[model samples]
Target: MSDTATRPEGRRVDRTSAPQQGSWTTARIVKLVAILAAVVVLLVLPLYVEEFWLRTGFAVFAAIIGALGLNLLVGTTGQLSLAHAFFLAVGAVTYTYVSGTSGGTANAYGGLEWPPLVGMVLGVLVSGLAGIIFSPIAARLRGIYLGIASLGLVFIGQHVLNTWTSVTGGFNGRLVPAFSLFGFSFGGTDSPELVIAGVPFGQTERLWYLGLALCVVACWFANNLVRSRPGRALQTLRDSEVAASVMGVDVRSYKARAFLVSSMYAGMAGVLYALSIGSVAPDSFGLALSVQFLAMIVLGGLGSVTGAILGATFVSSAPLVLQQYAGSLPFIVDPGQPGIVASQAAAFLYGGAIVLVVMFEPGGLAGLARRLRPTTRAPGAAIAADGADSSQHSTPAPADPSTGGDNR
Candidate 1:
């Protein structure tokens, strides 16, 4: 019945009195349940939601991936970059060029007609390669200088996308080839004639699952990376590069690695973006797109993965949902109409939200959530928490006479 343990040194330590890491507490159980419920809802959402909502969900998933990637670089590593759109373009352009059919009249385009899977993989790799190539520049620069340097990539990419018509299809853009795994085509309507709970699985529905799977994988990897050694090193570097260097952290190497990983994530998101729109245009990967991603991480909370997801969902979906319900919503009008357009309205809303977050809660939504969470510790646990808090702030105790100041 006792939670105390006797050590070989005749010392009694309270085990349960102090909260154990990873132990299943009431809050942990509730959190686990909530996560499982959310997953179930997402999995079955396609069965109930219409095509438009499914399409929007897929777009949100892609945004989440992109936001997470940016957070790793800017939020965790403290490396400012405005070239996310360029990386996304690289992935989209690479995928389209590699898998597309070679034919056109006025605007000639070319392709190798490779498998979609291969194209997707190559897209991610090429994006990462591009990131690594630019990592040296990223490594040397910091703050807005790095951002400005990265911004040049977007312009260069735009010019290449326009001038290199054979690969990019020029300003007109090229149609993105549908993603497929083996014989199963994600874009096809009746490839296998699948049905789920009486809901016919169309292209939208199929792509929804693919996006969901990729989003989950991306989030999972990011979460793990943030808790790993390299992640800690990056965070350390972010806090103080001099300190990190003193701690034996390879500053430049880690910076390069972060760029590599983050760009690859942007690449994956790019492929999804292309698939979502069914096309890749130079205009789509512009300065505005990069700013939007920056907004996502800032609004979500820089170093928090969950914040990135929350931020991405709100930022990506607000405009679409507003446009979808423009007729019913007040002061929201269609394009070329009288009042504010849905896109402008959505931007205003999030811009105000960002300003408020910056003033009141610099940690963004994640910090707000943490502050709002209920503290439901048991009495012993409360004592332990108090002790931990006191220990953090209290001055060091005098050295013991017998131990010679070697407490350990």
Candidate 2:
């Protein structure tokens, strides 16, 4: 069968939702300006804020990283993995176990003491291992089956953490080592770096730079992958495996490679999360986190890297962002276990947010941006009904009677 079948109307199509091609050079410039503006805000934030804000900002950055990782798997590679928390946990627990005291903070020993960099490296590798080990599932399953199979990873990871006290520190969990960069033992826990001239920045501030740098790298990698021959193979696999095979694409190998690469990104994110939190609890990395990642891709819009970051930024901050309301509510300071009224209301609101996005903006933040700033279309030579410009080609057509055709 063909990659796609037409309905009553004839039109080329792919089952997946990817962006249609057209250079939005003008809009792209605006988008770049907006992105840089956001980065500038981040750079200047540490000077104006205390440690609390710095930590919160760092969390947002970490969440964005996680979301971006998940996006690589689901959004671009056409994989549906809801087990992202497994990688995050793998990173966190790996850092905790391999570091200093070698036990959970709640344990008598306190925790491990590997340098922060070492722990980060471990996290990345462990997370990637988790992904690599799960590669077989991606090779075999598709759509919902694949999603469910990957979802098992979260439960499996949780069970391992909760049961393996020797390594993961069981339920109580271990604290991450105080991050030491280049022999600077955190300088001062909160604000590691002091001002030399007119600049003031904290550890969290420094972390924002790291996080931004990593995210940029991830974006670039994903962009390159999608624009390369391998990316073309990936698209072919996504569009239709059988047809792709006919085109000499190794369908299984390509998908497996995609999964492996996607997992590497996830592993890196996990390491970043471990570094940011300095602790790893079995409860922190759970199915809920996986769901959150899934929701992020949906909210960001699949196949769009920039949109993934946007989704991750918002979703990761959702809890803290909702706390103002939690504090205002009667006897509901804790959102995780709020009063009956607040709990129900919060659940409804969360669901409502997802519903709103699916109903109105299927492409998520990217779609909204596109609407606000439509692409600049050139004159006369419009993209044909299928989004292809026909001006490049010439085809013979019979002349009409009014135009003195040969028949006439």
Candidate 3:
């Protein structure tokens, strides 16, 4: 007998004809395998990579955090901000001052000598506070006006960094205190030695792992934030403030909150930047720095978490890599060599890339990735499957007696 059940209306239904649930398609299995393989490669890379590359990796990690933050504000929330460098400076300077010891010499500097963790936490808080304070102004402006208003913060921060001699070390800058956790250091050669697979884990290696962990956490948090309800609200706000307001989303409040959260992420990135460079200088956190971050989000694709990471990696690493290999490359030379310097060359390359991406692929790298991804089924396959199932399982309805004949 056919595997069917009779309904009250004299119709037969085939329970087995339903589509399969939770079945692992070939595309899904391939994606899972690819992700696992990439994770393994990232985990093992520090063991075999050189110290220079490890240092570059740490810088990339810091940039990734910063880019993610910028993407959330400008990309996801449709807020234009150029004060990111100011917030970064706030975090870096706070960490340096809170954790560093006073300079006993003529150019004296201040310090709290607190635990590094405390310094880090305070750095993030102070940066967030700065953002919160400026958020009111941000809520009042939009587009280039908001961006221009935010740009003022960078100048203000620069002035403070230069004149606040005791805290910021004046024009020359101050050393960043080494980070330690309960006496275990992630900086310097004096920390307890660690051996992994016959390779001595030095300061670079230790910092590499630390950076990796932090980057992972940053990515995870940003991904979750982008997928949450508030994320949807932010997207709505980006699309149309009136629509968002009608939907009961507090536009001003969310804008303020976005600034606060983005600033906090910049703070974390700033702390890592201080660690990577071993110093906090006023000249380092300038308008150019803010512009670089803007380039990152734009190149990576606005509103994409993965795109932020990719853009950060490219923008952060390009100049360094070009500088490293400049001697062998044509048309590129060292500073003052009367040729295209590595930094300038790198800028041209990415600037051109941005133009191309804008012209050809408006969605950026993330959208390109989606376009290239394999589909689980052929075109029209799902429709065909549904039709086949309906033909096999669904029964013709009973004739309408009231109409005195079949309606068909």
Candidate 4:
């Protein structure tokens, strides 16, 4: 039987919103298999990967979290912010003070020595509070103006971190207390001993898994948030604030919420960063860090969750990986050689990538992936996939011969 004949006359297919008739679509199966394969790979990676790679993976995970937060604010909400590093410093400093121990010859420093988990929670909360406090000013500015205003925050934060000797440990910075939960430490041998098929799990292996779990949770939450109602509202605001307000979206309120959520994510990232570096320094969170984050989202593609992850991996891992192989790579020079170092090399590479992506592929890696995916629609299917109403649609008339194929 013909499919068209089975349908009533004048009935539109509504292909954009209709459910798939097939039980096992090729796209669905591919997606399922890909996810399963990725999960399997992540599960066993710690067993085979070396410590250097494992540590690099942790750094990449931290960058992923930070990039995701920045993407939400800059890409999703259309806010150009350079103050992300300030919030990260806030979270890192808070975690250090809350979980650290008193030190120095004169006992000038102070710390509560609270549980690491409590410190992590407080880090997120304090970072969100900082965002909330800044939202009033953020709400008042837009575009380059807001970017300039946020730039000032980074300097102010740096000064505070440098001067706050008791809390921040002054310019030298403070050691980050090792994270532990329920008596199981993420560092040292206190982590439960385990032998899995002749492979002994150590601190590096344990931290790899920890980082994997957190990255998974961060990605999952970000994916869900971007597909929800609030995500749509933010996208609307990004495209046009006047239009969004006309559609009943509270512009200032939504902007504030976006900032709050983004900063909280940054807080989580900061905790991970502290753990990764084993210290929190005033110089660590600076304008350069903020620019690297911006580069991450830009390279990954704005408003694309997966692209952000890919970008973070590329940005975070490239320098460390390059430094590891600096002796072999032709153009890369060693740190003290005076030529372009691995970090600078990575910056140049991604900076060029940003320009190319902006010029040729604004969607970034995610857009490229979308273009590479196989099309699922059947041949001759007269259906739009963007939720357009077919009832009000019409086909264009045939071209006129006298107008030379142009519609006159």
Candidate 5:
């Protein structure tokens, strides 16, 4: 009897102590190496790329930031919004009107002449405030109804941009002040020219670095947000608002906060967009812009920050690149040519892609990328990693009272 008991305990101990094989160590090293390689490539790219590509890259960065913001709202919170362009317009106009000097076409508009950095900060804040003001409506409405209500905001904002002549320069638009920080202007240098690695670092190059830095920060912050507690709440809310409420999530508050965060991101993107275009016009913040933003999140894989960046890059750069190579490509032509315009071609491509993504792969690019990854794991590896055994994880059966606490 004693030997039998000892044998059973010995077997249990041996099973618990058995070493498990895993590929996690190798997988982690591979992931680290890949990240380093990508960072190095991005860092060195500017040294060799031409000015046009650099300019396009900056625009893509701005788009990426905007897309990330929209993903937070529509993808994460499950709220439909078409007023993103309105917020962008608010940011661009605020930045321009605040930083720009007093003088314009017919001297009709006025400006505060604040520092560019200050203007950028104020622009983001104003956009966020606008979002907060609209949050009440967002909280009340759901689904497509909310989408339509938000759409109305875009039309209202466009009208405001057109009629606010003194502030917005009416219909002609206003010039965007070049971004500068502490006397370092991100514009053409007139005296003691700036140079880097025997190459002149002009406005485009400077803006490229600025955009790159902001993009990195935005991506990092978004990833963190997605993985944190609030992110989980948002995801739960998206899955089922009633369930989220049962789980103690303040649905209304979270929804409102999501709007504020998303709009703030749009505001930042707007500032960058103004810099990229060198002007802000009423026509630029129409319904078309909002649709493009929606397409970015949809095509990139909803709720994925990295997907947002990828989608933005493709959407924002495709048209510019196509236009640049229109003559070399077939069927695509210049803006006024008989054939397809670059913008039209890009729209057709993304529109088709959106339909395919929705119909076939609801997860979008991110989900598709995950599907290509290997899912198999070493046996018992998960249990070992979790530091739990089957017995520990499950409820114990009741012991027989007559058998000294033993079931058998």
Candidate 6:
């Protein structure tokens, strides 16, 4: 009797001594709460912030949307892309050409005047169509092959925009009228304009809201996608193409779908970019721009959408912010006419960041955030902490199966 009583007490005591496994971990409940909080903040943010910051925030959102799209197709689907920026150009040019056109021949990619809506639709559709056509090649290639193939599209896109002077206005690009919704131009100076205290929201702020709206839609869709049958099929290919094929997953079709989805998102993003600037220049969508997009996806992590957004935000903002600050720094080189510190330095830093993130963290900002999360006796923390411990005893992959599959 004494032994039985003592044993039971001891067991209870031991259980009490140990921490709850899920208690400190990040739960789906916590994530939902955090997301809700973020949304609330975003809504309230524009109300209090100035026009410039509003634009800045919106730019971040646009980049996030585009990067999130890339993460889905490339991160989960394991496709390499280098022509996303060109797709962006397509969107910008298409939107502008459409807005400024007289129902007759509006300028298009190669100077084929098209109707506005038609031009926008055609631009996006053409990009998607290109994805399908390029799929067979994407199917045959991996790594550098896909990259090289995509690079060719960059030059082709540049040539099309440059040579098709009638449509793209050759090297000059085109001016775009403000994007309107429901008869209200986003930032128009007219009565329906977005104004607060006599300061109307500029093109950037208006475009930002447009971008945010699109981002919400994109994220919602992507969230559903990675959880659905199609998303599962994508992961099946990423992990083991042979296994996926053996399972009757049409790998070629999946890869093509990834490209198509990514391009579509890029196309939409281009619209916002053009609207924000109120103009489009061929130089804005150059080969270097494509490389930057690649760097964004890579640094953000291949398959994580949140990571993609974070990466895009940083990539897009870092340079401009740095250049502004660099000007105040003493002994900085005048990169401008007698200018010392130039935007070029920002690009160099961005490149260096890419290398460091790739070689060292691989998971980028998302990974860093995960690492910094306290593992204080929580549920998900157990796995994270377990893996952290296991990392010392065994070599582990940079991403977990769960996170690696998250498209957004």
State the C-alpha lDDT per candidate: 0.91, 0.71, 0.90, 0.87, 0.88, 0.72
**What are the C-alpha RMSDs, in order, of all predicted structures?**
3.6, 8.2, 4.4, 5.7, 4.9, 9.4
Task: Give the residue spans of candidate 2 off by over 4 A.
Answer: 1-25, 102-113, 185-193, 196-200, 328-347, 379-408
| Backbone collision tally, model 4 | 0
Ranking by TM-score: 1, 5, 4, 3, 2, 6
Least accurate 10 contiguous residues by lDDT in model 3: 375-384
Q: Please give the distance, in angstroms, between residue 241's alpha carbon in candidate 6 and its true position after superposition.
A: 1.4
Measured on C-alpha atoms, candidate 1 has an lDDT of 0.91
TM-score of the candidate numbered 6?
Answer: 0.79
Among these predictions, the greatest TM-score belongs to 1
Candidate 5, residue 252: how far the Cα is off, in Å: 0.9
Candidate 5 lDDT: 0.88
Per-residue lDDT of candidate 1, residues 23-75 (tens digit): 78888799879888988999999998899999999999999999999999999
Worst 10 residues of 6 by lDDT: 3-12
Task: Compose the digit string of candidate 2's lDDT tens values, residues 34-61.
Answer: 8789778877767777766666667767
Ranking according to lDDT, highest score first: 1, 3, 5, 4, 6, 2
The weakest ten consecutive residues by lDDT in model 5 span: 3-12
Candidate 2 vs. truth: CA RMSD? Answer: 8.2
Off by over 4 Å in 5: 1-29, 106-108, 189-192, 376-408
Supply candidate 4's per-residue lDDT for 324: 97
Candidate 6 wrong stretches, greater than 4 Å: 1-26, 102-122, 191-204, 330-335, 338-342, 376-408
Query: What lDDT, from 0 to 1, does candidate 3 have?
Result: 0.90
Q: What's the count of clashing pairs in each model shown?
A: 0, 10, 0, 0, 0, 19
lDDT of 3 by residue, 369-393 (tens): 8888765663345655766677677
lDDT of 5 by residue, 210-253 (tens): 99889989988999999999999999999999999999999999
The per-residue C-alpha lDDT of model 6 at residue 22 equals 51
